[model samples]
Target: MTKSQKWVSFLILSMTCGVIYQVAYIRFVFLGPTARALDVSSQDYANIISVFGIVAMVMYFFGGWFADRLSPKFLVVTALAVTGIADLYLGTVPGYWGILAAHVVMAVAGMGLYWSALVKAIGMLGDSSEQGRLFGFLEGVRGVTSTVVGFVGTAVVAASVAEAAGVLWLIRLYGILCFVYAALVWLFVKGDDRRLAGLGSSTVTLRQLWRAARNRYTWLIGGTVMLMYCFYTTLGYFSPLLEHRYGMAAALVGVIGVVRTYVFQFVAGPAGGVVVDKVTRSTPRFLRWMFAGCALIALSFLVLPRDSAFKWVALALMFALCLLVFASRGVYWAQVGEAGIHPDERGGVIGLASGIAYLPDAFLPTLSAWWIGDPSATPAVPEQGGGYTALFLFLLAVALLGLGLTTLTDRTRRRELAARAAPAGAEAAPLAA
Candidate 1:
């Protein structure tokens, strides 16, 4: 591909991937508005997300299979179209069941079809050596795209006569972008070598997938992914936390959400990618340390005062956590290269890992709802403090678990590399001696 073509493809792929998650991301900023629109309790709203997660977990596996067997262009186009329709439907402010159905469609399109295909296609854009930078750039650009949405959506909502109408407008706007990106992907994303299709007979594909499923590295990495997601997903609650605990306005909290989630991603993604390639030179090693940072940050969240006096301190720590998480996210997939899996098996391995990794989607939202209660309804007072405390404790545990798993993954990859080098080193030693 020409330089221009590569840049175009990268931009399209990144932007498409980024915007596809607005249905979910928008909720982070406008949780109360969404719940009120659905006429459901905050807990019920979280259950809706749990339902989406449950469906998406299943879809993540199938998405991987489709990515391996189908044309990425076709899969992405279909996913974008489906997502667009779902977002438009959601904008109608359908009642609970209607909203639930829309989320299911999003699961099928965004999580199941679009994500793996997007990742696999991105892998094709660069040579093996560039995997870190490529995925990092993907994350950075995704940040940029999502940040654009956050700003625009916040502005739109603030400008609207009613909160519900603003939220609806935001949802519809995302839907329209999906259609636009679907067209761009169809026109601009080209050059499909059979390798990019993940070509193999069905039997071969199944066999490879089975092998990938059995690999310990897959589960370890998947567990690490799950824990990282725990952090990412929980960060959304910080919006409500700030609103209730710090007496911040909803509009101001929304802006903070944008900064914490998307704005930080812009710097973290590319920086993490470059650091992995040039500094640590090992993705898992880099992640191992970052997870340590996550643990420390989570610890701080637990110990720090949630009172108004230390709200800025809490915000500062949250931003630090965002940096670690987004940066780690940018480069975590590079573990595929470090694990020494064949290129052909990328889909199966990624699929299985994703399936395992995203399980929190099914459980975390509901669990968090139970743990944190309605932040809007319940303030974090010293006398009644279990809600936010429980939430922070869980985050700390996830961080510690992730830290351990990433350390093991790093060691395992290093050992495998050393084992492979042993025979070659022996041969060279005899000649040199």
Candidate 2:
């Protein structure tokens, strides 16, 4: 393939893989069934969400190593196929236990290929100057495409006979789609080959991964990612929160979510990326400002009161929150891009970063549910604490935690950076080594 053909194929494949695999972001499937089976409250649902974070942390670690060693096209396509199979399981399997099992399978598949490898693929599509734009575009595609996938998945699963057996049709359909997408990626994609060559290289040894993982900057950013989700978690469940609070139909609430995806993701997310690039370039201390912005994100949630004007104010606050997250997501991953690794190291390091960054996905939902209610319960009835005020407050706390971690990471990173740049550079030797 020509270089241009390869870049386009890489971009297309990366996006297709991202959309197919982002089902985790679409909703918490097992949480609902588990809530039903256990008769638990939303608080318990939050706990279940938290459990996924734990799982994600492990996946991130292995995935990073896998990304470093495997071909991005190969790893990603396999993940799609495996996750699609899991989707089929959810459609056809019986019982709550069966649903939970499917979730587990999908999560495992996600770990085998996503994150670091995906980011590395996008990075290889451009030079340093183009990384921001490429990644920005990918994020936009991620939100838009995943919503489409989620809607289709939900519709197919819903349109079936409403039984495990009937839902098998949906599963089969998605499985076919997933497999087809994966095969297309395998056939057409010509993303970075460095990942393929890196596995045999000695530079990306366990020792290097271990050393990088110990770096203060790594821990700080990783922790920041986990905590950042606390506020972001509100978005994950915003629909249910609406249903529980305003007596809106679950279907209507879902429609609002689609709106959220389209508006901020398509309209606002790219704007945020440009703003971040400009800020990073202009500022002498880039991360310091990034850290400070977290506080503003946290503060945005304070806009609405519980008993006062409902829909508009609440939707507005949520919309603003989405913008903040959309704006910041690319920058969060920029640290990895900026680390200046050998082409080979990018995938592994990206995997490590993703694993560490997503620790909260495992648990954030559980925490959100605690604040909102158990995730497993029947559709939340209206006028409950799971409504606007409660959800916003919870999200606010998450922002605060993210802000704090960002500040800590930035401060320590500066001191270290300065020390390394000092005349006596030995004093500034990598601390985490």
Candidate 3:
């Protein structure tokens, strides 16, 4: 594809991937209202999140294998259709079990197909040099798409007679948009099948996939991605934190949640991309420094006050935290390219990495729900033990671990480069640590 065609495809693919999850995690975007609308408790709602994670955790592995064997166009289009239909079913105000089933369907369609396909397609769009910028742009575009839709959902809630009704309407809207994205992917994301097919054989064996899984770079990068994701997963709790701490109104909390979740993403994504690609010239080096900075910010959250007077201060810090999380997410996948995995192994490698990275999706929500005790409880209640504080402390630990893993990943990269540049039969020169 020409550069222009590649960019156009990139934009279309980004937007299409962006909107697919809108309804799947409505609970995170509009937590309180969703719980009330569905008549579920905080713990029960968390169970839904856990189930989605469990399904997705398994699908991620297969999704990568499927990416190697199938066309991106097929996976993306099918995922959208299935997700749209399932979401429309969810919009019907399905009972708890039905809602659970809907989530399962969406997870299968999304994690099992669209996600790995999208990652592989994006990797194929640019050479090793452009990995950071391409994934960064993908995140930026996705953030903008999600932000705009969030506002629309917020407006729908503001105009409706009841929160449940508004939420139902929002689900239907997302469901329709899925079909629209499917059409867009079909029309614009062209000519990728041959390019990707030529890279890997159709009959990729499990033994080869297992070998890819065993690569050290895969685990190092996967560990980094996994830790960053733990931070990312915990971010959803900020909505409830602000609401409970300050007694903010639901509408206000929803608006703040939208901003906290997505607004900074556009700035964070490209900025991270440029820094990694052009400035540091190494994704792992950039991430190592970024993780250290995030660790400090997570520490601050541990001591931050819950008083209403300090609410805005807390919000500012959360936004800063969001920026760091989004930036890390925008480029973590670029390490797949930087790690020098063979072209044929990229999809399987990403699958294994993603399986590891997204493992938090399975357990974090349930663990957070347990840690937080009850969202309905007051923040200062001594009996509750300040749930958010405990959560942030866990995040701080993740950041530190991520920093160490990233440092090691960078060292591995340096060794690889040095070895590649060495003459045949010559020893690679070692430098001081």
Candidate 4:
């Protein structure tokens, strides 16, 4: 295989293994804590996730900047090492706060790896024009990897129910897996020169970074991303939402999350890339299709009743909603490059878009928990969590806002294809260009 292929394969495996460590353990955190054998309240669980999100945002910014200034290989590999340590403690820690703190460490390490040279590394492997496809492949594989890990781990854990030590060992196994995970990422990247190997003395200043952040399309696309993730964010909690409303079991809910990953939605991610390629001949007008997707998604949310009688409807809603949202995310990032941001600034633009767009990760769960979270609502106090009414409304509003933002891009680049025809240094350059 080519060197770039080798690097990406390793990074993909690293990201998958690293993510599996967290995903497999998610049930054991403040919310589930199966190993501690404690059944924590959902709100408490949301709080821990919120904390991780907050710290993760910090890493997103710092990591992106670090990628520009330092070697991402070291940042990523070292962060992976730290994450392994955090995982080790997380599984073994008996205290609630200790586990929570460990999550913070894991978030920083994971986000650091996400930005640290990895994104840039992959971007370099493929031609600029093919970014949408590249991101699609990466994300598609990530979905597949996470799904496989969760399934295989579940099989092992489920089959070990007769023995208590088996369950503990399974959780501990996840930790040791991280060490092997770190070693693979290390071994593959041992002699890599992908980071800070060139670009001596040439980089955008923080001022340019600010301007990029301030760009109108930046806000538009970032908003698109936020809306997109607001939906992906729901995928995990969705099963619980089902269990709360319909009285489902862990086995069923697990099926829902897995189906959402491998079958329900993730398939749309790369499929969206193919759609974008087919329509790029029309340039920015392709965004209109995205806007249509958002509108339909919001309309469905609006149509979904807040009452429990429609719980099955909610499942169907997310099953369809995720497909649209993932499709939109895959294309929106590609549009950044399509809209003509400089190739040199690709990572920064992606970083800025990603950094700003993902802010919802920091707090949406709490908002969800606050809603449908009434103490007097149900007997399943910990499960009932909060207000579904307000949460769905919040999601609806964001989707509408995304629709508005998309139109602004549509209007601004009304003649994008014509503009693409203009030669370099041409005086009559397109305004959006």
lDDT of each candidate versus the true structure: 0.80, 0.57, 0.81, 0.60
* TM-score on alpha carbons, each prediction: 0.86, 0.73, 0.86, 0.78
Maximum-lDDT candidate: 3
The candidate 1 region of ten consecutive residues with least summed lDDT is 424-433
Q: Please write out the lDDT profile of model 4 over residues 78-122, one tens digit for every residue.
A: 666777677667556446687678778877777755445566655
lDDT for model 3:
0.81
> In model 1, what is the error at residue 187, expressed in angstroms?
5.2
Candidate 3 TM-score to native: 0.86
Q: Candidate 2's error at 427, in angstroms?
A: 20
RMSD of 2: 6.1
Two-way lDDT contest, 1 vs 2, winner: 1
What RMSD does each model have against the real structure? 4.5, 6.1, 3.6, 5.1
lDDT of 3 by residue, 1-433 (tens): 8888899889988998678998877766687677667677777778898899999888766776787777877899999999999989987878889888999999999988898788778777877688768876787789889899888899898789997788888889899999998988888776655556544433345766698778997799889999988878877787877888756677887887778777867878778888897888888888887888789888887887777888878888888888888888778888988888897787567767777888898889888877786676765555243477778888889989998898888888888778887767667767425
The positional error of residue 269 in candidate 4, measured at the CA in angstroms, is 1.0
Colliding residue pairs in candidate 1: none
Put down candidate 1 lDDT per residue, 388-418, tens digits, no spaces: 7788888888888887888788777766666
